[model samples]
Target: MEDRLVMDGLPAFGLEVGAFSSVDLVTAYFGRIADVSNLNAVTDPLHGIPILIKNNIASIENNNTAGSLALLGARTPRDAFVASRLRAAGAVILGKTGLSQWANFRSSNSSNGWSAHGGQVFGAYVQNQDPSGSSSGSGVSAALGLAAACLGTETDGSILSPAQRNGVVGIKPSVGLTSRDLVIPISEHQDTIGPMASDVKSAAYVLQAVAGQDPNDNYTSAIPNSIPTLPDYVAACNPDALSGARIGVPSNVLELFLDFDNSRQVEVTSFLSALSTIRRAGAEVVENTNFTELAAWANSSAETIVLRADFVTNLASYLSKLSFNPNNITSLADVSRFTKTVQPGPEEFPSRNTATWDAALDAQSGFGNTDPRFFPFLQENLFLGGEGGLLGALDRHDLDAIILPTSFAPGFAAIVGAPAVTVPLGFYPAGTPTVMNRRGNLVDTAEGVPYGISFLGRRFEEAKLIGFAFAFEQLTKVRGTVKPFVVPKTEIRRGV
Candidate 1:
């Protein structure tokens, strides 16, 4: 009667994100002893394969948090598009992973990975540390090998930060390539779901199985199924990808980190050295680019204004369509109210309200402080004037892609909606040599931490990005996996 589908080191089959291994996971993996006739077909699609989902996607008829307590006991009527694909691919629908409450758009001060239902997902390296949000649990689970891979959604950095903090591969697909009919929303313009895996190939495999045009999502109509269907990802891992490829180094992002964290210099040292490998690989590296104008443009008030408009407008439509009772609240207002209850179950709201309220207050203050010049600066300096911003930079330099660090530092913190990818460069040991800042100041590492160099491209260029990442990974293979609940033991690899 023991189900062959059951396996150790697999994720739970129920709904809670990053819920510890449980009887349910065991049952899902191995069919029930009494159900022999059905047991033959009960093989976990994800049998030996383990993966986690962001709490937003509904699978296994379990609770869908969307990182909000309002839907505490709510059961989504059906499996999300990606969840169905994961199941079909023979991947175990591991439990849902934690995320920033409401994908971190609900509040400004809302920590990146905290949710009333899941609390905070911890970093794989340091247990008492930040597992960068929205997709925090997915990144953590992938890094620790609690599962073979995991899924994470992003409006922005949610996928990237966790990947950076957990030291793994995180890819944010083109917005329209993947369907979003059942997943929670952030911004239709930017919201997307992608894979968080131990390496680039695994992430590509998940994407291959799940990506396609959906009848439900209108935005997807514009993207061709052939584009997402391309399988060159694994084949594109040419160690020679760097050769003949033009890479632009944004001096602006480096300067921004220089101002924020002195330790960033230590992280960049390995990154710069990694760039040398690109040169050794025969790529041309261009430095001393002035992208300051573009950097400031991205963080301006105009962007926030755009986000707010979409948040209110899109959310209203989504809530109006949902069919639910009073207990199953749907709107932001209802969620805010439900977050205040002191209940015993995961839906208990008192603690969550604190994070939500603080986020709201911070958002208001952040908006007020944003400068108006930032918008025109973007139009004139980056997009129009052609200094940088993916497309502009790529065309101006006649390049394949641009490279930059995924984060200012290797450590994690709270933030919402930023999608990023971290590939191996080389390790920056605890006492490694450091780099000089814009002001020509030198610095050293206080501790050993992993750092990565990133390649950026125009929107919808994930295939290129993945191809480049595959090449880089094949060359370096720096990513590592940890045995769950155990302390890390190896020196982190770089640029893999």
Candidate 2:
């Protein structure tokens, strides 16, 4: 396989400068392993496009590392439901991309996109800065055009944050819109996989190919029958789609970390810029939408106790059933101890291991019905009742959709089982707001990094979101490329 990839031409995005450091490595790998001759479609039909699947995802022929050494050499007996869908659609499975260890589930202060097996993945547009975590490599590879599209899973900020950093379009589908079977688990309740691509159209195409029913994932049952079919995602991109759409600018999401993360300012500035762009594109922009009235709900605890319990028990059971050896390490406690004693490879990227430690110590919270932290009512309704709440606003205003900064603000924060998406609005100015200090001071950082506003709407409203994004993209037409690298074109990889 390595020999067949030796004569590769440079990737369209030029990611092969110093070493096989980016998606070029993925493209090269696919050319070696797959019989890609029958595939067709690049960014449009998505049939034959080369796709970089995150390491956490299962590909029968590849290792499912989840960016951790713990799963080293563990081969999946079959493809993940999503991976199978891609193959059936004629897509080539490009090699896996590097990611934060355990999708940044290990610690709190961990760096983004640093994996033990693949090292650190840089934001292609700005090589020096962090590529926001968990699914960071998938985002970077897509941005560099290593493949026409890539698959990224999100449990919170993983997908969206990296997409913003890498200058690409990412969609973290509704909780159950995509299947979770065969993908390494964080929290079954919130885990989902979606497409990350160079543009919204490409992302939409990939999403269509992968979003559908699966016996392995019962969640797909919740998908509505009224929505247009997956292949029709491009229809959402009406140039006038935003013409009369009412966009809600939630002031509270903007203030979520105001006291601790000053990066909010840089993001706020960018959000304002995006709002202006939306208005110029002819949308009805409503600034200062409030979600604070539901603060109790928005800030409600995630009931991680339930999540942890499920993880340990379920994981142990799953491992036991596997044909592979069940190490003396069966619980999170054992895994934590193992990680502490072993030094990962130099290319390894680390996420905050402290969080994993915290989760492990508190695993008992999930053990029995005795723990008060186990299961609690989903108290807040940010997605439910307020003017800024997703459903409420959409119903009240008869809006076509709404847009936000894609996140509270970006920095390095990891949470398991949450989902979201990020899109590129083009480059942000120097000294963009970033890192926060204990003193509550905001530090300006990550100059030359890309910043994008996020579009979120009612659950299952992906079509609207994608359409709106496509409309914005068509208006701006700001395609980005990675900083040039000096290397042989023959060493780079192309699409599947």
Q: What does the lDDT read for residue 442 in candidate 2?
A: 18
Off by over 4 Å in 2: 1-49, 226-231, 256-259, 297-299, 303-310, 317-321, 326-329, 342-352, 363-373, 377-388, 409-421, 431-444, 481-496
Q: Rate the local accuracy (lDDT) of all candidates.
A: 0.57, 0.61
| lDDT per residue as tens, model 1, 226-264 | 544654555655566666777777676677777777666
- In terms of TM-score, which candidate is strongest? 2
Global local distance difference test of model 1: 0.57
Cα displacement (angstroms), candidate 1, residue 3, comes to 20
lDDT tens digits, residues 151-264, model 2?
988866778877876777888887677888788777665568888887877787778878887887887877775224543676776777788788877566667656556655
